[model samples]
Target: MTTTGKIVIVGGGVTGLTTGVALLEAGLPVHLVAAEIPGPTSVAAGAMWGPYLVEPWAKVRRWSLVSLDVFRGLSDAPATGVRMVSGIEAARNAVSAPEWNTLLLGFRECSPGELPTGFEGGYRFTVPLIDMPVYLQYLLRRFREAGGTMQRQFVGSLDEIDDGSVIVNCAGLGAGELAADDSVRPIRGQHVVVKNPGITEFFSEDTGLSPDLVCIYPHGETVVLGGTAIDGEASLQEDRVAARAIVERCAAVEPRLAKAPVVASRVGARPTRSEVRVEADSRSDGAPVLHNYGHGGSGVTLSWGCAQEIVQLVTATG
Candidate 1:
């Protein structure tokens, strides 16, 4: 009943699974316990590798870059559900390139003709687009192969962890309660999946200025059209109106999406904060605990980087 010598990790989403892999690689016995695997949130993500809404530019850049490399290595491994796809991000105005742009393949400013009407500028790059369900399963298989253990249950708080084990909290939004973090809140996102209309690439626009999402992520026979990032809202109910809006906007960008039959709708509550927490802390009794959550929309994009740092923190503090 005790995992005294094991490194216990909470959460079974991408973050926790990725952490388990990294910890096992660092030669540590791992025990992962979470309420869900291939979690409700991550499974609903329109997950592409872009540092969209995470913070601390320097750390985000570093973490995203490391993850980019890791994902690229997995691109050819079809079972992993990762693909290197070219996409365009249209900006209403000119902007500087992202710091991690140097790490992507074929990243460059878009040509004048490439910009859709009303877009002043944009950039095209090839980045890793993840099919979360498949990728999460792959992570689970890889974790077990590395000799890690997992349990399906709810953890009330950090105090429940075994006394002699070093704990890593990759508990995503649940960290709000587990770690007493008031800063962590949900940024609700929704996506609509449709039968692919033979679209071969991906497309997205910054939804900050716009009131709705205009994006399309074609994954083989199923193309994902989304989405909505309504901050502080965590409801998972299917919003027909919102789904309609997503389809309409995406269709305006890619006409084929207008006719693709709606296959499904997904919802997720992303853990958002001013910045990601990837540092070592302690419990009331001074037991070592390392936090690795608040990744917002960049959980997959920052997974390996944060996991690598978690390993370093454990090595230094263990």
Candidate 2:
């Protein structure tokens, strides 16, 4: 729709930044405000591009595929920190192939020999694995270069935003308070970064419905080992116990990780909901509002697709 001012996007994680970039690329004026841009949580992700624990498979499938295509294009640019890496996602118990397997390149069931020692069933495919820290900066730079502006300030409530601007509520976990969305809660995730001992491919355990996850993602010199998904847990403090467990679990699957020196630990609370929110609303002051959060573990996986949808929502409003 026709706007009197620039679009204001809340939350500055991958969701907000990606949305900001999309809007700018669409030739719209955009302003992003957040307490912290390039949010720590986004930086701390084991951000391989397979939809993990997000929901509403129908829409997620579409969004994830769109993002997969975009990431594939971005992979050609090393500065974007996107890579097309082949990997195995296996399970210790018998399981059906993932419904989205057909969406990836070179989709195939892993042969028994291809499966790690204890994995009973799994699939092999190539997907974009992101180095989040570098990627976030790339997004930020792209946003600024496109003439988008940002403010590093706390946005307490939607009511405080009275400007006649379209509001994109990407506040993530903060949406629980800003939008009064009780369904929005935190799913605590922890990852351990270890020195990469000459590894190239990625590996993940298909731990369905389990709080603990086993995954190893190598990014050049460092590998990110993950993770835990504790629902309703919001604390960002590093959990040594969880870190140790992550390293041990990964080491079991990839013996080379056994002696990898510990580098760092990361903890983030995924903004999880019963289903992802990517729709429109209105503020009390009658300003247009678009909700785009609750991505859970698939924030990076769904960022671009969701951003594109937001762009359409903005156009429809006009």
Candidate 3:
């Protein structure tokens, strides 16, 4: 078969799905393949807003801005459970260059009441938090509606995508092995989803302690309490110790949540790199490949913008 009519995308994570949506929007056909059951997106406690947190990837902040608008415009925003939320983001002392604070609406000082212990002072901003399970389903639905196709198979290398002239790789942590990308290591994040009706808002702080900071956000049926960032860790076995640590730290931040029933615990390895990669390159076997991985902890936060860039790269090459 000739490798020219369609584009093949590897991976079914948030990055892959969003890139598929963007490419379809740009008038292209896509075939997405993954090893596991094509499932929903997940991991992490809260989605941090603004560009300041992303460090050198200042474009990530811009991409996040555009992505928020895209998600807000989607017809299923309410059905998919995405919400424009306000949260308290604190820091003990400011980093030399914050990447995102100034980019948000109402980015200003948090009132004395919102301040948690150990935080000197910080800002409050309204940002979008993605309920990944819902959002991933939304993206998959859109891709199917746009005439995209999916295959269930593990692609161990770039050669497996020979059905297309161009392949966009968004394979998350798999890139570490598949692409021989040493930078694409996993950052393990553990969180607890609880049944808490009393916690209606999101609260977070930069506490320098075990399990580090705490963030609590409501997602319709469940409340997300999180989390800890264990860099270079790739275990998804749901550590009981980590789960208990998350719950305790979160309750310490918001005493009311202490009474909430823990519904379930989840662990995911975030595909992390020093920077978010959304550039075009050739695979080892000389297949045209556009890489759109390394989202780290911000995959959902900046999906659309990076997708847009990926689509542009593919289109320009085509």
**Cα-based lDDT at residue 316, candidate 1:** 69
- Evaluate all candidate structures by whole-model CA lDDT and list the values in order: 0.88, 0.91, 0.73
lDDT of 3 at 162: 72
Of 2 and 3, which scores higher on lDDT?
Answer: 2
Tens digit of per-residue lDDT, candidate 2, span 1-318: 556578999899999999999999998999899999988789889899977767899999999998999999999999999999998999999998887887876899899999989889998888999999999999999999999999998999987776538999998899778888898989999999999999899999999889999999999999999999998899999999888889899999999999999999988999999899999888877788999999999999999999999998887652
Q: Each candidate's TM vs. the true structure?
A: 0.95, 0.97, 0.90
Candidates sorted by TM-score, best first = 2, 1, 3
Best by lDDT: 2
Q: How far is candidate 3 from the true structure (C-alpha RMSD, Å)?
A: 2.9
Q: Flag regions of model 2 displaced more than 4 Å.
A: none
List ranges where model 3 is wrong by over 4 Å: 1-4, 37-45, 48-55, 92-97, 207-211
Candidate 2 pairs with clashing backbones? 1-318
